[model samples]
Target: MKTLTLLMTMSLLLAFVWERVDMVRLGYRIERLKSDKVRLERERDELRVKVSSLTSPARIAKVATEKLGMVPPRQDQVVVVRLEPEAPSPTSLAEFEIKLAKHDVSRKVR
Candidate 1:
């Protein structure tokens, strides 16, 4: 009976220590994840700032004129093309108009 009680006590202590070790390991993993999350968030913020700077109008215009040789159209060089009216038949224009009306109605409803 004494041997059995000793064995039970040892088993309980072992189980408790195993649980504590598992908790410590899980806590370490959680800390690592939090550190990684903070690093990634900082990187994301830096990238967002970089993107905004690159997409600024002055930068875009400068790059277009310098690197791509793109220039603004002069008033005399610009020619406007007028599209002919589509037929009343079920054409793409009519379909687009129907979709637009549906969108407008949805917007109004909202």
Candidate 2:
């Protein structure tokens, strides 16, 4: 009976020690993850600032003029095409087919 009691005690002690070791390992992992999170957040903020600077209109315009050698179009050089609304044609399937055939024939002639 004494031997059995000693064995049980030793087993409990070993289990307690193992639990403590596991807890310590988990604590270290948590600390490392926290530090990684902070570093990543800082990097994200830096990238956001970089993106804002890169996307600014002034920067875009400077790059366009300096690197791409592009110029704004003059008003006189722009031509606007105005489209007039066409009258509604066939509503039935047969009528639509006939209209399409006629349009195809006209296009072939042109």
Candidate 3:
């Protein structure tokens, strides 16, 4: 009976120790993930700033003029394109309503 009790006590102690070790391991993992998330977020913000600078109109214009040797268009060199307004749709609501009214009136007359 004494040996059995000792065995039970040892088993319970080992279980407790194992659980504590697992908890510590999980805590370290959580810390590592948090740091990684922060680092990635910082990198994303830096990349966003870089993209904005690279795509800015002023930067683009400067690069075009300096690297590509592009020149601004003179007044006569520029061409303006005008888009004509589209005609109203054939099946407009007003036309549909007029047709519907005429059909109703003719039916009533009949």
Residue lDDT tens for model 3, 30-96: 9999999999999999999999999999999998888876656555554555444356665643322
Clashing residue pairs in all predictions, respectively, total 0, 0, 0
Which consecutive 10 residues in model 3 have the weakest lDDT in total? 96-105
Model 2 per-residue lDDT tens digits across residues 1-110:
99999999999999999999999999999999999999999999999999999999999999888887655655554555544336654653322211111122222221
lDDT of 3 at 43: 100
TM-score of 1: 0.69
Candidate with top TM-score is 2
Ranking by TM-score: 2, 1, 3
Worst 10 residues of 1 by lDDT: 97-106
**Model 2 poorest 10 in a row by lDDT:** 95-104
Better of 1 and 2 by lDDT: 1
lDDT per model vs. reference: 0.76, 0.75, 0.75
Measured on C-alpha atoms, candidate 2 has an lDDT of 0.75
Clashing pairs in 1: none
Which regions of candidate 2 deviate over 4 angstroms? 79-110
